[model samples]
Target: MRLGLHALGIGTGAEPAVIRAVAGAAERSGFATLWAGEHVVMVDESDSPYPYSDDGTIAVPADADWIDPMIGLAFAASATSRIGLATGVLLLPEHNPVIVAKQAGSLDKLSGGRFSIGIGIGWSREEFEALGIPFERRAARTADYVAAMRTIWRDDIASYTGEFTTFASIRVHPKPQQRRIPVLCGGNSDAALRRVAQWGDGWYGFNLRDVDDVAAKVATLRGLCEQVGRDPAELRLSVALREPRAPEAGRLAELGIDELVLVASPPQDPVAAAQWVTDLATDWQ
Candidate 1:
């Protein structure tokens, strides 16, 4: 299994030198990708329940910088040559699909096709309200937005008709250097698994703390793929390490996972962060 860093801390107000050091170290150490996560806004606490943590509320600092995922990954891309850059999961329902497709395609073109997109229908009602998007329809909207983006990427003259947005034949220039920019969908629910089978290039299971569930989810995804007539092996499987579950790497690989994306703590100094990553990888990878 390939190893990757789930996050780089430039957005935590870390200095540029630290960002470069972390990205450089990870790349030089043969890590496959550097991923950035997205969130447009956050509050002190909420009843909405942070699905990733043991406690419901997300533990992000009140002052934490929720930088734009693509821009952050673009910076990481500039710092390295070959390491893939990806969004661990960008909140797809919040943004305009045309604009996202342009940005992602531009980054992929600029990075020599080293960009991949991992996406999710966001869970925060407040964030949705803040953006004036209805939270309930986000999943359906996300499906539409992804379809639209794929159309933009795949065609020279792309036209789209969808529930939220539509346009006549128009081309978005500087298409991704790759024939298609890979999009990995994140979530473990039935709807999300179906979305991966239907719309995504891969499955990125979010907040997957239980190792047993990993095999179960993979089984479900493979069964769904067979039902859809898609070869299951063609789909990549990756998981974000929510906390410090250090011993499951081999088990996950045995279950047919393609990648393990480890999360790094937010620290202003890059040297420690780099070393911690190296230590974890040395023991696991």
Candidate 2:
């Protein structure tokens, strides 16, 4: 499996110049991809249980400088040519699908087709409330949004009518360089696996604790693919490790992880963090 850097430290490491330095260094050092995630707004308190940690705590503080993943990726794309840019997982249900389709297509165009989308139905009820999106029925809404975006991406004069979003015949220009932007569904629940089997290009597992966790998930995914009549080999299986390094990275690869992304930071210092990640990335690749 290849190594990718999920820029989790950006909450603190986020100077414009610093991002450029780190992204440039990542490309120069041969890391395969650089990923960012999205959180447009945050509240001081939420009943939401964070799933990616041992104890369910949202890692980033309420006042963190979490930039829009797309914009950060745009900045990263400008700084580096070869490394892939992704939203590790964008909150798809909280925004307008048509506008997002346009933005993602534009980003792919700008990046020379190096953009991939990771998405989820999400767990934060308060976040859904803040966006005025209903927390219940999110799964159905997610499906509709994905279908609408696909229609926008795949059609010349696109029109889609769905329960959540509808549009008349309109031509959206500058289609993505790739035929379809890869959609990796995040979350490991049965519903998530079904979504991946039915509509996604891959599965994106987050904060997977170990190789055993990954293996069991992959096995379940394979069975889901069978039930859906989709070939398992056609899917991209990637995982995000919240820890800075996974000693079992190769072991996970052996169990069928195509890409393994590790959380990293120069959390306290940009230049120093940049150089630190730069040095580690050299050996990682």
Per-prediction tally of clashes: 1, 0
User: What TM-score goes with each of the models?
Assistant: 0.93, 0.94
Residue 19 alpha-carbon offset, candidate 1, angstroms:
1.5
RMSD of 1: 1.8
List, residue by residue over 1-285, the lDDT tens digit for candidate 2.
887788742565466777887788778777788888877768898888876777777878889888888888988899888998888789899889998888899999999999999998888888998888898999898889989988889999999999999998988877888858998899977788889988899888888776787888888989989998989889988887645355687787787889888676554566776787777876665
Candidate 2 has a TM-score of 0.94
Model 1: residue 46 alpha-carbon error in angstroms: 2.3
RMSD (Å) of each candidate, 1 decimal = 1.8, 1.7
Residue 110 local lDDT, model 1: 86
Error of 1 at 21 (Å): 0.9
List ranges where model 1 is wrong by over 4 Å.
9-14, 243-247
Candidate 2 deviant stretches above 4 angstroms? 242-247, 267-269, 283-285
lDDT by residue (tens digit), candidate 1, 117-236? 999998788889889989998989999998899899999999999998897899898899995888899888888899999878998887676788788899999889988999878888
* Cα-based lDDT for every prediction: 0.82, 0.82
